[model samples]
Target chain A: MAGITIESITKSFAGVTAVDNVSLTIEDGEFMVLLGPSGCGKTTLLRLIAGFDLPDSGRIAIGDRDVTDSPPGRRDIAMVFQSYALFPHLRVSDNIAFGLRMHHVGKDEVTSRVREAAELMGIEALLNRYPTQLSGGQRQRVAVARALVMRPSVILMDEPLSNLDALLRLQMRAELKHLLQDIKTTTVYVTHDQVEALSMGDRTAVMRDGAVLQCASPMEVYDRPGDIFVATFIGNPPMNIVRAVARDSVVKVEGVEVALPEASNLPAGTEVSIGIRAENIEVHTEALDGALPATVAVIEPLGSHLLLTLAVGAESIKASVRTDFAVKRGDPLWLELRQGSVRLLGSANQSGPSD
Target chain B: MSAAIRRPRRRATPQRQLAYAAAGLITAFMLFPLYLIAVAALQPRTAVFDYPRALYPSPFSIESMAFFLNATGILPALGRSLVIGVMTVVLALALGCPAGYAVARYRFAGRDLVQLLIVSVRAFPILILAIPLAVTFINWNLYDSVLSVALVHTVMALPLTILLAASVFLRVPSELEEAAMSMGTSRFGAVWRIVLPLSRQGLGAAALFAFVLSWNEVFAAAVLTVRNPTLPAQIVGALGQSPLPFRFAGGLALTLPALVFIFFMRPYLFSAFGQARS
Candidate 1:
């Protein structure tokens, strides 16, 4: 278990930067996930930390050792690849023992470690079978077992659960979280799925266009995004940002005047945006004070809950409502933004207001 | 269930029947020469040359095979051919596997040029290269030796062996090698332990091709070597004066060993070729 620090790391291919000037510190034994859309450099960042790729310019250190230029084998890291890359010719036992054999571990130690890792992965019955004989889920288990048997200080996984079916993916996700927690190994997991990062990461780094937008606890990223990109990318339905003007302690959203908190500071007629999440939008049938009149455009019943998509003036927003609320489409509705729910975002060049 | 089976029969239009018949006829046409050779090899000496070439041998016996096997210096030539074939395969594999790997894995300065050269070598005839090498062999005092024949055969086999093995190596996802490296195996160790084992069937197919190519090559052996001639060269040389029975029996003997090898490798061959397609 070791902490890994990446400072100003950049990687480029044919003049196109794959990972550009990224910096992050993963504390000892933290499950840090790099989450982004596909081709957003999350995997590249993981590979850079694993020493599978060398940064064009920067330094990476694991524990106290500088590993920027070291080969992956010398970096003391193990990786479970996305494809599960098990050796087809070797049985599960040999696959698990591959690293041990390469490091010249004695026969008895290799056997014990292989058996132990296989048992940990719940694949002891499959020790003698080849990878081709295993199903997708079993192959994933074997891949994880192979990586675990190495006992590396840091374990890096690149979308390891992407190949499994949906139900299997969820089961394996829980299994991976439980296993990592028990072992307390420092792990860096990369995936394009925000849900995976939100559910599994001790801290999640949201990335876009080869740079990290925010790295924080899932709640911090959800409740307090640093920029419009994070505000838009981190949430499931995402935060809604509408054009508005903030001036003289008052914000006008479209044609409606919204009262700002006393002591709120803003210049007169300042152009800004107001951001709100779906859960913060309160729906009412009759027009009331501090509420905007709207029409419910669509209602989606999600078994235990309902999502009412409403159109107010020319702007549309979604509100999470209860399932038995008896709301239908094409109904007149008035929704009010909860107290302090509206977050004012400054102009494009200016940073968004901190939560 | 009976109607379901009969539906396909009712749907078999005239065009479909003609297509099926054509395929069957073509297959039969391709197999006829092999059938004729086997029949001739089994006939008695007098029956081998009988008019209208017997579709089935009358009084079929192993007499011709016995004669061919017991001929003066024939068995020695066959042994020499086997040795040369095996040696050629070993050399091609040793030289080609790493070169193929380098081509597949690395991005050296002249990588594209090197790959192009290997591919272009196939377009030219091997006989064109063999003739010059034969002269050089005589000058170097390697003429009429197994080494000379095997060396020339290696050149003939290297390009295809390298290309095929390189394609095979490419099919083995590089992620496996990378995963091995991540597990603390050096690059070479990863390839040696992982990639090589995974590509065994491909290597076997490459080796089989090299062996068959060297085993059946007559031009290089005929031109470069004399006393230690391969079986093909011996049979060709014997044909100049030997009777019909000798030619048929010798040709049959030469073809049988390669057939045995192909049969043994039939499953792997089909799989390797299928991988090549995919």
Candidate 2:
């Protein structure tokens, strides 16, 4: 296994930049997930690391060797594509053994390794089947087995679970977590799904518009996002931001005063945005101290919890509450914002709430 | 509820019956000329000249076929045509497959221009090319040779072969080749092991098309060769001089190989044509 170090990589296609100047270090045996929305350059960065594409302006090092100029075949990395691009003409065993054969491994060793990979992936019974004969989940397993059989130092996966159905994606997500842990390969996985990133990655890198927003552990990314984009992009239902003007110790939002963190020293009337996660807001049936009165606009039942869309002044905010709360649309309620849960953004680039 | 559970038996509507009748008429119309040729080839020479031209063989005889086979230089011409057809298919595929793969897989300057050139080559009459080519060959000392005729046939077959083979290669997913390369195979090795095998059926269809094009062509064959005439050239040269049964026998012989080739390529022809349009 080897760590990959990328330095200030930038790539452009026909005058439009797809990957900007970005640098990252994927440690040895680390399961790093590059998480972002579509067109965020996560997949392009993975392809760059895999040597399928070259960065126009920077360097890439796998282990201690600089492989920025090397071809994909000499990079000693295997990739599981989003399409599970198995050779249609080859059976499962042959597909698994193809890399070993290309490396000129002995015939007996290739067969044994293929069988071992197949067994490792629980696809031993499917060794003789062609790709067309396998189900979607089975084909996914075969693709993973094909990558694993090569035993490359790094394994790159580009949305490998996106093609599976929701249930199968959940099951395979857990299985892949365990599998990668057992194998202990330096794996770089790219996905737009935050749930998968948080559940599987030892470290998650959030990206936007061809730039890395934050690279940290999943919990830190969720709790202490580095920027407004990372704050809104990481959570379910996303974080809600209300534009406010900061005073010494409190911020004014639609004539209501909310306490700011103690270290906040912004000038009075400075433009700022206050972010609060949906789950962090407490709903009260009766009016309470320091609670803002709001009207419930919509109620969504989610079996275990209820999502309430509240019209607070002119802005609508979502709050997750216990399902037992018998709140209907147009019901008057008071919402309490939890202390230390609010993330204040004073940067000019921070904007209003995102849907 | 019980009636809903049981499926209704379908009866052919008048529109469907009319469609069937129309299709049957078209099939019969297409097969009639083949039947007439077979009948004339099987009949005696005297019977072929009878009133209304025997739609059915009155007296079956192999005398006309025997005469055609025994004619001086006729068998050698037939052998020459077979060799030319086989060589044309081989050469066209060998040259056209790579060109087709490049056109299909790569983006380069003048790629569209190259395809336009290939397509436009078919716009001009082959006789125009063959006449100039005949002069060039005579100057190069290649006149009246089977190789000259085969080379001309390859020129006639190459454009369509490249187009068809390009479509064939386009049907193989490029990601499979990328996967192969990522798994330690070089670009060429990936194409050889993955793309080639996946595209075997389509290439076979392209080869069959080249064979049929070479087999049925006559203008270039006649213009390119004189002493070493191909079968079509020999038959055309014998037209109006040979007896009716002998001409019909030659026609039937020329059509036979194409039919057999199509028969062998029946399964792949469907998908080949389907992908070509795409």
Candidate closest to the true structure, highest TM-score: 2
Estimate the overall C-alpha local distance difference test score of candidate 2: 0.87
What is the TM-score of chain A, computed separately for every candidate?
Answer: 0.94, 0.96
TM-score (C-alpha, index-matched) for candidate 2: 0.94
User: On residues A61-159, what C-alpha lDDT tens digit does candidate 1 reach at each position?
Assistant: 999999999999988899999999888878889889988988899999999999999999999999998787789999999999998898888999999
Clashing pairs in 2: none
- In model 1, residue pairs whose N, Cα or C atoms come closer than 3 Å (at least 3 residues apart or on different chains), thus clashing, are none
Model 1: number of clashes? 0
Model 2 per-residue lDDT at A132: 76
lDDT: worst 10-residue window of model 1 chain A: A346-355
Query: lDDT tens string, model 2, A1-355?
Result: 9999999999877787878999999999999999998988999999888887789999999999999989998999999999999987788898999899999999999999999999999999999988878999999999999999989999999999999999999999999999999999999999999999999999999988788989999998987778778888888877777777788888877777888656578888888878888998988989988777899998999888999899999878899999888878899998888988877866545653233
